[model samples]
Target: MNLTPNRKEHREMSTIVSRVRAAYARIEAVARPEIWIDLRPQAEVESEARAIADRVTAGEQLPLAGRLFAAKGNIDVHGLPTTAGCPSYAYEPEADAPVVARLRAAGAIVLGSTNLDQFATGLVGTRSPYGAVRNAHDPARISGGSSAGSAVAVALGIVDFALGTDTAGSGRVPAAFNGIVGLKPTRGLVPTAGVVPACASIDCVTVFARTLPEAEQALSFMASPSARDLPPLPQRAPGPWRIAVPPRDQLGELDEGWAEAYEAAVEQLRSAGAEIRTLDLTPFTEAAAMLYQGAFVAERYTAVGSFVDKAIADGAADLDATVTGIITRARDLPAHQLYTDQDHLTALRTQALSELADADALLLPTTPGHPTLAEVAADPLGANARLGRFTNSTNLFDLAAVAVPSGKVNGLPFGVMLIGPTFTDDRLARIARDLEPSVQLAVVGAHLTGQPLNPQLLSLGARLDRTTTTAPVYRLHALATTPPKPGLVHVGEGGAEIETEVWRLPAEGLGRLLAALPRPMTLGSVQLADGTSIPGFLCEPAALENAEDITTYGGWRPYLGS
Candidate 1:
């Protein structure tokens, strides 16, 4: 819980124990017991932290070293009972689920089980017997479920990240409500061998993190290598991205504040260099409806109908009433109806894929709006369905999605989800980065607008911010490389303001751009004429061995002309 770190820290062994102690203190201060179904003892978690430190000190490379995480009640964490949000059905798991085990192998410590909607049946956090999970932003509002506790824990900074399961937006809805990043990797990408099934065939193990990078980092370790022979992702050329959004008519009843926030998020996407297009939500809507309205709910019954039936027969009130009703009713869905629904879904998937074939990703409000605890209590079924407006069809259509908080509405968080075809997880990440804050980059040579390598910046979605110059404290050298390049070197005594084009790109893109850059060129702080420093291109002194000093020309373009 070293909140000061810009990124989730890779804790040094020396501070790992203290960090765990601090995390426990934060947990107590927050005082929201409903967030956890079974929190591990302080001494137990501390022991694991110390063990990780010891291993790290012994020359082990653990990417998630000393990171703390929680498993949704449905996902097995060794020694903790797998509840799937129904205490009556709790059973001791012999070992951690593969997803949890992978994280633990990489040095992430599991704190214990988090609360969720009983049997993972509802989108509202209220369906759990443990008590409603309050929104981290506002206690009066719902924290979203069936991953309620998982999302709230991450939002409250109680854990670095948590594992959640998504069948019908269970992972994403809560993320939007709690203002965190929910990453639903392609189905089968993260093994669900040990997770209690909500809808076994379509269930996806998801990650909830405070930021996109953190979520992406956690997913890297969780996802198995691609084994399916799926179609290759479309190769996008250098230019603005094509993003599809639902037309006004397709957007279900949205609160005014939420509608405005979503419109603003679309505008932000446009400003980030995306071409907005209208996508018909008919096919997606149809597919989503089949999950509950049609025979697909039978899949849920197939997963845990027996247990639910037994609980009801025993007159156990531990089962959520609404959840019980849904499962019991689905039990009677005729076998032929399931196939009929599947055939219908196949056609709808084809239609939806065709509609999205030309787009990079489909962007939608993560949910219609944030519902309060009272709203859900008032009409359990109606309120919960509204929250899945944009999230339900993803698994059915075999898509990957990432839900990210865009902004606030009525002092509550509003979020958007970027959905793409399976195996497009990486592409989705790049596109989602557009929604993040950008950094100013100063470019002096080939990367300048309209120059030989300018397309590189365009491909990475970098936009020209403005034309500017460095504070008269740099020397420009023309490096002798293929196509040639200019190197700007800061010289304290004798230098001139070098002509530079200030471009902006997301921090993630900047990292990628820097990594692919040719040798001898480095990205470092460049002092601007206004006495501000920003990341810009520089070079090693070795590159200047036989290069031309174009300092007199003041810039790359002018020197070339001369």
Candidate 2:
């Protein structure tokens, strides 16, 4: 019944597939037929499994090797009807969305397309004609959407991850409801070549995974730019990072339990050595308001107006009344008004970006609070808007974000989002990886506390060693490398008390750090103070030819400082 699978369990390939099939069977047994308008047949699923098995047997290097995932119906999958949860608007897509194609190429098997708020319109899952996707933690509560089914699938362990779109918190709100990781990469970072547009300029292809590492892996494989995609944004290096959190007063009527959960999460980050500070999010809030209140709604109308008008004319669309009203209003907005709103949005984006000048990431609740399905249904538009209070601003400001499960409140899941400036997807992922407790690694080098690279370590979510040390007989060398590197060398005997520190890094950051490391230094097993060996940095003996033997100084910082 456990949805989250740990790779460390070393479950056999057949067993993993069996678990997935069993989960699907259980889903069928529950008979929530309305959750999805179309479910892939067992024969099709089995065929996909066989294909995956053949690939694995051929020894292919599949990034998502043997993993199962799903995509929101709005995103195309060849041969499948992409209804976007409105049966009347359904059509067969000739090709997969670029994002889905990348995932499949990386060894991920698609189970089937999931339901969504029709045309990816509503933040609440209830707008779908297919059925309201219930919150995973509490069926009575609403599953924040339009990525509703994608989040529920991962939360229920139906897949390793799911692809969703975020125009206004669509990617993140469902993650909060399901207690999963929702990553909204920078706009245009993941191509939208085949995705049905919600807001073409601001739409982001997003991922929902059970863990931060899983989400990051999916992001790495899917973040490539293509001819149809936008150009890559420049990368930013880490530094002494400043993280901003929303002021307590700005949370806006969060129930007592959610308020307590947010505070506890902030404390946890503080304990992890993050410089948590409060900043006014008013500018960001104002930008979010523009998404709906300003002429931005006209953009959504522009994307789907022709099709919607045809459907309405034919009386074939089962559009939600609220959506119909909103779209109709968009039809009446003046061109000049749209231009004015665009200028206003540009100004707000400028102001929001300026606020992040001193901060590497901004942290906030994924949503103000969780609302029940009944609550949302009774006053659908109002409840849906409230759920988007914290999320609507993200796309408007063109920010990258990762929503991490911060733990539960009153049996309902709560999440915290790490927001960074555009194209800093990798940086935000690194920080989120550190915040997650599941990924564990050992570090030895300038990354250790009091060392030259310690700031980088802290920015990536590293914890300093307090009661750790290196093996007694190892020699430490100070490598002649920029940013002042250190080398830990193992020796036979009579070695000095070479001071060192140990740290645990998340797998994503570890990969990035390893990739960026200069020649001569690499990650390998190092004997710890207690005779145990964990993955740490060591240098090739050849590098020592020009390196300084600073074993006497005990580690890199003191040696480099002198």
Candidate 3:
């Protein structure tokens, strides 16, 4: 998790490489060989590492210098086999996929090719012959796929980041389950040439990382206009922003834990000064239904149709029944129906575009809910379709998304996805990074400067806020609780200024801090003198019902010292 280097605290490139090498050694100690269909030899990886190190040492501003990452097996890595999770369908590529080549050019070392659900067909991680990928947080749970191994590799700290494909929820689902960040870029934003297509028109190369910053770093390196056959993307200006959230009716069978977590996440954003609004998701939901329920399934067949036909003719079909059935069904559709589906898709796109016009981004759950490996196996197709309820329309509508870890539900990770119109990738990443819980929580209580609790914040990647002040209307009360608790009360109209210090913590750290808080004290929105609000500590009304009002002393520290 401590993969990023401090921008101000410079270190030699060799040092970074050595740190990564040491981490990889640990991965090797518990190595699951089957999780990889093909791996770059140790010598080759080291050689690439050394070359990257040399470039960084020479003062080249390689944005991803000394970082190691992996690609899904379907993506062409020069000198490595492109198997698409099917050995019989394997072929040696003479060149790296355009996206991979770009990452390499930016100084990232390609560690190896990871496994996936066969041909990227299922959302569950068990369909691959290479092996079933286990959850990073809990081995018993499914890792979520077809980006299963890619998500696992990052969550387990095996690599700084990794690449996967997202036609459905292949990219975001895995990230959500594994507690990491998954970025499914706009179609054609990251070139897909040399990548085996699941549905070529919709397939997008995705990135996974432990944090949004790392994912954005990888994305910035990989996104570029292709020299050949790249489609056009929109250009928009940035300013006052509006974000759309799903109407309550569409939240979709969420568990209590997840519902609470999502609500808390939204409150956090509101506390950070973001204007949250509701949007009718009917258009998006309708378009998502068409991905598999309509003729778009035929696009997958069109991508691999000839290969499938030839393989079947040779008495060897290299496809899973579910995938074959989904693809073959497309053949039965008449040309007229296909055209009709396209026209319907066009209408949906128009409706979506109009709905999104007033907002800069759409916020929704990355997946409707999480399903265990056993649940997925019991009904593969149904469970997989459910996972894509929020994601299928993204690529089809030509939108980009960043799936960020919101928080945990009963110890299981959940995420919220931020979707935007094409070419807003940079803007979306910026907002997502800011919205992350850790970054927005302004610690001002026992965890302030030079206190015992300060180190806790530091350990969670918090930075000191130089300009700090307390709520002008608050009166501090010495609470009758453990850990020397304090209570803040709002004093209307006439109030005294209080002393407080603000410290910035990351999203992951904020969750830890909240979990550690004792009863009666909780995190809530605190308004400052200048009319700005941020996440801070507050006491339940019951806790302060009998407490004495001590507004005369100004703040807790002053009153406590007296």
Q: How accurate locally, in lDDT, is each candidate?
A: 0.88, 0.77, 0.78
* Rank list by lDDT: 1, 3, 2
Candidate 2 per-residue C-alpha lDDT over 1-562 given as tens digits, one digit per residue, 9 for 90 to 100: 2322443233435644675587588667756654565667766776676666666655666756667788898889887898877778788988888888888898787878888888888888888777888887788988888989888888876777899999999999999888889999888778888888888998988999887767877888888644234566545455445688877887788865888887887777777677777777878888777788888889889888887888788887588777777777888888898889888888887887877766778988888888888888788878877877888989888788989888778777889888998777777876675466533344556676666677766645556644366777778877667656777777859666555566665544576567657778877877776777777778888989867778887665567668
Candidate 1: list runs displaced more than 4 Å: 1-11, 234-239, 438-527, 531-562
lDDT tens digits by residue: candidate 3, 246-314: 777787787568777877777777776677888889889898989988888888778777776777778
Give the clashing pairs for model 2: none
State how far residue 556 of model 1 sits from its true place (Å): 22
What is the total number of backbone clashes in candidate 1? Answer: 0
Winning candidate number (TM-score): 1
TM-score against native, each model: 0.80, 0.76, 0.76
Model 1 TM-score on a 0 to 1 scale: 0.80
Scored by Cα lDDT, where does model 1 land?
0.88
| Backbone clash count for every predicted candidate, in the order shown | 0, 0, 3
152-196 per-residue lDDT for model 1 (tens digits): 999998888999999999889999988888999899888999999
Candidate 3 TM-score to native: 0.76
